[model samples]
Target: MTAATSISPIPVAPVGLTARARRFVEVDSVRVPRRGLGQHRRKWIEHGAPAVEIDRAAVFQDRWGGLALPPAPFYEGGPRILGAGCPEGSTDEGWSFRAGSCRVSMAYGFRIGSDGAFGIDAYRWTPLHASTDGWVESLALAAHAGRWAKTVTRIKGKAVESLDLVGFEPVPEVQGVTDTWWRGKDSLIALYRGEAVGLDAPRCLEAHVYGGLDEWGLHGG
Candidate 1:
């Protein structure tokens, strides 16, 4: 004989996503605190110099983990959410224009395949030709380094559909490139530099490669 029992169904919020995919992306140059346990330092020893000197300065790996939120439109006429795309409670949290001194921004998002493949998504970029103190100074710095000043251009809304357009060439033979990315208008760029370096780039890259396979539509096409 079997005993009769009553069961209740727990109400669950409908998952807002169609297919929860994970993406890792790197954004370069979000200022970090100059002093702390993880403050940056570098060392160099001249060939003829006596002792090696540690340059307790300049950029170092300050990467931290965060979440990749769905690409939502940032419209002046639409509702905007604070801390969009970041993990529920992470130090990497804030709204756009929340002062560069506070928190960093999401740089890029890339999908990682289950069999270990990956590609670029949206890019984060700012205009190069701005008439402001910050813009002029940034341009000057890049020129000083004999390089071009670059900012991740925003795509407004919607993630880029084509990976190839964002410099993710078909690497049928390689698992993944020692690559990084920065978001730009409707696309991302795969590279090691140009505001796509160190922590900003690697954290996002790792997310795609190791963090979010299922969410990124990895198993299938």
Candidate 2:
């Protein structure tokens, strides 16, 4: 009798059983609207005649942009990145100013055209950078403010002793967490993780406690 050979196939699992978890800490993308400086600046002026500045060397606007001012960080000696935060989302320019101590994560999407605008998003951990020191919580909030995450734009003081509060905002949709050092201007400005929905809302946003930043080895400074 001839020897018989046998072959076995590998087992397969069902697709539904192996689907990804849809509700376990989802990070939505940030949004950037098409509005320009002339449109959004009005809000800042209404709040207070917040100073605005536009960079000439930036890629987005040659000389036609304004600051997306928020509030100043409670502490001094913050971290700042040049050419970030612009009004019209573009691949050209952006600016960010972060003082105090904070940890921030940012994400943005883009599209190109004559009248095109992109989406921008950011997430922050209050007292994010503990080693940075001073108002570590507040600093993290300041750094991740909507004003800083949208576009690469910059603002500077005309004089040496002026207080400049650079700001950023999310595009009305994405959401996450936000804690309260306080809320809005005149508030303590703590990290508030949450989501953005419709230019003035936080749809599915949430926040965790802000404490023991030192345990993360980020608050010793």
Model number with the top lDDT: 2
Q: In terms of TM-score, which candidate is strongest? A: 2
Clashes of 1: 19
What lDDT does candidate 2 reach at residue 113? Answer: 19
lDDT of 2 by residue, 50-144 (tens): 34332211333321112111223421122121122333322433322221122243232211112222222334212222111112223334344
Misplaced by over 4 Å in model 1 are 1-154, 163-179, 182-221
Tens digit of per-residue lDDT, candidate 1, span 185-216:
32223332212332334322211111122311
Candidate 2 wrong stretches, greater than 4 Å:
1-194, 197-203, 212-221
Worst 10 residues of 1 by lDDT: 17-26
The 10 consecutive residues of candidate 2 with the worst lDDT sum are 18-27
